[model samples]
Each structure stands twice: as structure tokens, then as C-alpha cells.
Target: MIEVRQVTKRYGTKTVVDALDFTAKPGQVTGFLGPNGAGKSTTMRMIIGLDAPTSGSVTVNGKRYAEHAAPLHEIGALLEAKSVHPGRSAYSHLWGLAQTNGIPRRRVDEVIELAGLTSVARKRVGAFSLGMGQRLGIAAALLGDPAVVMLDEPVNGLDPEGVLWVRNLLSGLAAEGRTVMLSSHLMSETALIADHLVVIGRGRLLADTSVEALVQEAGIGAGIRVGSDAAERLRQVLAGPGVSVASSADGELEVSGLSAREVGEIANRNNIPLYELSSRAVSLEEAFMELTRDAVEYGKVAA
Candidate 1:
């Protein structure tokens, strides 16, 4: 487990990350999400103690990272893959970390195999492809056999197979009751992997909740489509309570909030929709957009 207590960071006079508080629990993958210059990196740096917080505090398990007796065994992080020495082989690099941390040298080979870098373990890291470098970085993170894993953009450069491999690896780690916190701007990938989401905007907490709760809170329910006079009638029936009704580009009624089942119930109850009725939930991408739309610090203007 990890706890961030009112953490804040500043560079000069600009506050990059404001007072934010959240907890990352074990047995789940928590996604850290934000747009460009939204302080995602700064916050992550604070979490790992790479950058000191101007105020507040962050702890791995129950203590600051530097204070932990065996930091690697407590928390293993892949904040940036390029941090490794280019000239060193993947095997040697991990060996060095294991040696310094008093971890068994045998763990290096295990991580190499776990990350699918066994074939290139002896090759210089600089010569490896971007995907290979990412795998090597992951291998280093797992070398300590830590309880908490933090990965920043773990899939930044990888083939489809590598991407799937990473997803499975995160799930497998979390299933074993280890805390896994991964940061990524890719909502689709996060949606598929994370059980919880910790979204930040302009360095402040936007949402800290489960994926299912976020989808429900975003009101992404099945959409209703109707074109007959029943359209207006069905609209009225769906309008009550928490539902939202709108017209699609094709002139079909789009209803959110009520499920297809409930929409069909109302339609059948009113002899209305005989056209189209299907379950339609808003994807994680759409929900993330809605959540962070107001928090983007910068964006390109329309041409």
C-alpha cells in the first residue's frame, strides 16, 4: 500500500502539483492519468522520492522511500527506462542493483526470464530496441521482488504482443496482492488493465474511484434510439430522474442513464420504440475526457 498526504510540488513560483491526497491499495492496479503538463510526472516523481515535495508527504507502505530499510524490496519502480546505463548489459545492470540492495543474484536471471529478456540479457542495453529496453526496465523493477510496483508509461514503446504481455503482467502481479500503480495518458489501455483510477488535472485530484464507479458516475448507460412519434413520448418517459436525452447525428434519439432493458421496458410500457434498442456504455476514453476536459492546462487550437 501507498499513501499520499496532501502532497504538493512547485518549481519557482508555479505550483505544479497542488495539495492532493489519495491511497493506492494492494491487490489492484491503480491508474494515474492526466494530460500534458497536468503534473502527472511531477506527482509520480514525488511518489518515488525522485523529486522532493515542496510540502506534504508520500510514503511507501508506512515510511518515506529513503527511510525504508530495503527500498528496492519495498517498492520497485520503472519511472523511466532510459535511466539504465546504455553500455551495460541487461543482466549486468540488474545484477548491480541486486548486489547493491543485497538481493540474491539469482533474482536477476529470474526477472530477465520473466520480462522475456533472457535472449538479450547478455546484449548491451543501448543496442536493444525500444520494446526491448522497456522489457529490460521491467526486469529491473521485478528484480527486487518488491511488494509495491510503480510503472510510468510501461507500454510507451512496444509491439501489440508486448503491450498484451505488460497488461497480463500487471494483472498477475495485482492478483498476488501486490500494490501496482501505473501512470499512463492512454485511457483505453488503463481501462483494460486498471481496477481503480486516480485521475489528476492541473496537479489536483479529479477522481479516485473504481472503474465501474466512474463509468456509473459518468452516466454512460445504454443509448435509446427511436424515430416515431414514440420518440417524443419515449423521450418524456426517459427524461425523468437521472437520464439524459439527446439526438444522434442521424436523428435517432440517444438516451443515457436508462439501460436497454429499462428503455425497452418503457417502450413496451408505452407501445413506443419499435426501432432500435441496444446497450451502449461510454468507453473509458470518453469518461476520461469528460473527467479531465476542464483540467487540461494546454491544448492546440482548432485550425
Candidate 2:
């Protein structure tokens, strides 16, 4: 498990991460989300001991990353995919990392096959494509067979198949009761795999909740889309305190603060004919935007 407690970081006069606190439990995929310049990278750096926290502490597997006798065996991370030497082959790069932490040569072969880099295992790193580089980075992260896995934008430059493979791999890791924390801007993909989310903005914690709970809290697209010949009449009937009825240009009514059953029963009592009534489930992207709207540092100015 990974625990970040009241962690803060600073550079010169700027604060990058501010009192951030969250726990990534084993047996679940926790998505770490934030906008650009939101201190996510700094926070990840602190977790892996790449940078010291100005305050508070970050622990992986119940101890500081540097304190672990075999740090790689405790937590494996992929912060940068292109950190490898260009002159080395994929197999050589992984082999070198394994040697540093006393990892076995067989484990190096295992991760190469697991990451689907077997065909290009002997290819020079400088000749590999972006997708292949990402695959190699992932292979390095799994080289230690660590209890905790952390990856940032693991799907970057990946094709649709590679994306699916990563989704399944993270899910499988969580199933084995490992602590899996991944940072991604792809909300749709994150929603499909992450059991929990840790969202930050402007160096502060914004949300720590389940996937369903966060979207529900946003209340975007949480209304019922009702279509009827008598839309105006239906709107009138549905109008009351605490209930909202909005009409679209296409003449459909979006009714909120009421359930589908409640709307149907009310319409039935009023003899309003309805052709369509369905709940508009909010997407994860919509919820993330709503929650972080005020925290965006480089927002576009409206004309």
C-alpha cells in the first residue's frame, strides 16, 4: 500500500504539492488525476524518493521508499519512458536494471514477454518506436515483481490493443492484492479500471472517492431526458420547488431532482403522453471538469 500523509513540496517561492493526504490500498486500482501544473508529477516523485518532501511523509509498503532494503522489490515505478540509454538494446536495458537490485535474469525475460516486447527484445532502444518505448518502460517497472506498482500515463503512445492490455494488466495486479496507482488524463479509460480516485488541483487535494460517487456528486447529466409531443405541458406539470425542467432546442425536456419513476408517475397522473424517458448518466470527463473547473491554472479566456 502507498500512504501520503500531509505531504507538501516547494521550489523557491512556489508550492508544488500542499498537504496532500491519501492512501492507495491493496487489491484496488487507484487513479491519480490532476490538470497540468497541478503537482502530480512532484507528488509521484516524492513517493518514490526522487525528491524530498518539504513537509509530511510518503510511505510505500509501510516504510519510506529509501528506507526499504530492496526498494525496487517493494515498489516498481515508470515515471519516464525514455530514461533508458539510447545505445542499449531492450534486453540489455532491463538486464542492467535487474543487476542493480540483485534481481534474477529469468525475471528479466519474464517481463519482456509480459510486456509483449519479445520480438523486439534485441532491438536498439534508439530504433524503437514510441509505443515500443512505453512497453519497455512497463517491462522495467514489472522487473522487480514488486508489491506496489506505480505508472504515469502508462498508455501514452499505445495503440488500442496496447491500451486494452494495460487495462487488463492493472486489473490483474489489483486482483492479486497489489497496490496499483496510475496517473492518466484519460478519464474514460480510468473509469473503466480504477476502483478509486485521488484528484488534485493547484497542489491541493480535491477529491478522494469512488468512481460512482464522484460522478454522482458532480450532478452533471444526472437528469432524465424526456421526450414527448406535450413537452411544454410536461414541463409545466413537472415545474415545482426543488425540481428543474429544462427544454432543449429539439423540444426534449431534461428534468432533474426527480427520478424516472417519479417523472413517469407524475406524467401518467397528468395524462401526458411520453415517447422517451431515460436517465443521462454523467461521464467521468464531465465530472472531472466540473470538480476542477475553478482550479485550472491555464484556463482559456472567453471572448
Candidate 3:
């Protein structure tokens, strides 16, 4: 597990992260989300000890990342995929990393196959495509089979198949009871993979909750759709103090403050014939936008 307690980071006179506190537990995928310039990268850097925190502390599995004798075995991270030497081959780069912290060469080979880089394992790093580089980075991250894995934008250059592979890979890692924390701008993918979320805005913690809880709290694009021949009558019947009913251009009733069952029961009680009643699915992207609307640094103005 990764624990960040009251951590803060400042660069000169500017504060990048402020008193942030959150935990990424084992057996779950935790998504780190925020808008641009929200200190996500700074916070991740602090966690892996790339950048020191100005105050508070960050620990990986009960100790600082640097405190572990075999840091690679404790935590594996991919902060930047293109940080490797251009002269080295993919296999050579991973082999070098394996040598450090006493990781064996066999494990390096295994990760290469796992990351689908076996065909290009001997290719020079500089000649690899963006997707290939991402695969290599992921292979390096899994090199030590660390108990905790952290990645920033893991699917940045991946194609559809590669994206699906990454989703499955992260899920499988978490299933093995490892702590998995990733930051991504893709909300749809994050929603599909992450069980929990730690949302930050301007370096402060906005939410640390489950995916279901966050979507429910946002309460946008959530309601029952009522289709009936007597749509106007059904709307009036369902209307109450806390309830809201809106008519669509197609003569469907968009209802809030009541479940489908309640609406159906109310309509049945009033002898209103209903043709269709279904709940509208809430989009994760919509909820994300709602939660971070105020926190957006470069929001666009209305035309």
C-alpha cells in the first residue's frame, strides 16, 4: 500500500502540492485525477522520492521508497516512458535495470514477453514508436514484480488493443493483492479500471472515495426516463415537492427524485398506461467534469 500523509511540495515561491493526504490500498486500482497544473505529477514525484516534499511524509509499504534495500522489488513506477537512453536496445535497457537491486535476467525476459515487446526486444530505443516505447516502459515497471505499481498516463500512446491489454494488466496486478495507482486524462478508461479514486484540485484533496460513490455524489445524468402515451399526465402525477419532471421533444418524461420502480408504481396507481421506463446511465466523464468544473485552471468561456 502507498500512504501519503499531509504531504506538500513547493518550488521556489510557488506551491505545487498542498497538504495532500490519501492512500492507495492493495487489491484495488486507485485513479489519481485532476485537471491541468493540478500537482498530480508533483505528488507522484514526491511519492517515489524523485522530488522531496517540503512538509509531511510519503511511505510505500510502511517505509519511504528510498529506505527499501531493494527499492525496485518494493515499488515499480513509470513516470516517463521516454526517459531511457536512445543508444540502448529495449532488452538491454530492461536488463540493466534488472541488474540493479539484484533482479535476475530471467525476470527481465518475462516482462518483455508480458509487455508484448519480444518481437522488438532487440530494437534500439530511439527507433521505437510511441506505442512501443510505452510497452517498454511498462515492461520496466513490472521488472521487479513490485508490491506497489505507480504509473502516469500509462495509455498515452497505446492503440485500442494496447489500451485493453493495459487495462487487463493493471486489473490482474491488483487482483494479486498489489497496490496499483495510476494517473490518466482518460476518464472513460479510468472509470472502467479504477475501483477507487483520489481526486485533487490545485494540489488539495477534493475527494478520496469509491468510483460509485463519486458518480452518485455528482448526481448528474441520473434519472428515470418515462415513455407513455399520456406523457403529460404522467409527469403531473409524478410531480411532488422534491421531484422534478421534464418533457423531452419526443414526448418522453425525464424524471428525477424517484426510482423507476416508484415511478411505475405511481403511474400504475393512477391507472396511467406506461410504454417504457428505464434509468438513464450516468457518464463518468460527465461526473468528472461536474466535480472539477470549479477547479479547472484554463476553463473556456461561453461564446
Question: Model 1 residue 172 lDDT?
Answer: 97
Residues 1-303, candidate 3, lDDT per residue (tens digit)? Answer: 999999989899998899999999999999999999899999999888899999999999999988999899999999999999998999999999999889998998899999999999998999999999999999999999999999999999999999999999999999999999999999999999999999998898999998899988776447889999988788788989889999888889989899889999999999999889998876778888888888887778889
- Candidate 1 C-alpha lDDT tens digits along 1-303: 989999889899999999989999999999988888888888778877889999999999999998987789999998889888999999889999999899997888789999998888999989989889899888888888999999999998999999999999999999999999999877889999999999999989999998888877675454655555567677777788788989878767877767777778877887774677755666788888888898888976889
Q: What TM-score does structure 2 among the candidates reach?
A: 0.96
Residue-pair clashes per prediction, in order, are 0, 0, 0
Model 1 gets an lDDT of: 0.87
Give TM per candidate. Answer: 0.90, 0.96, 0.95
Number of the top candidate by lDDT? Answer: 2
What is the TM-score (0 to 1) of candidate 3?
0.95
Model 2: residues with Cα > 4 Å off, grouped in runs? none
Better of 1 and 2 by TM-score: 2
> How many collisions between residues are there in candidate 2?
0
Pairs clashing in candidate 2? Answer: none
In Å, residue 117's CA in model 2 sits off its true spot by 0.8
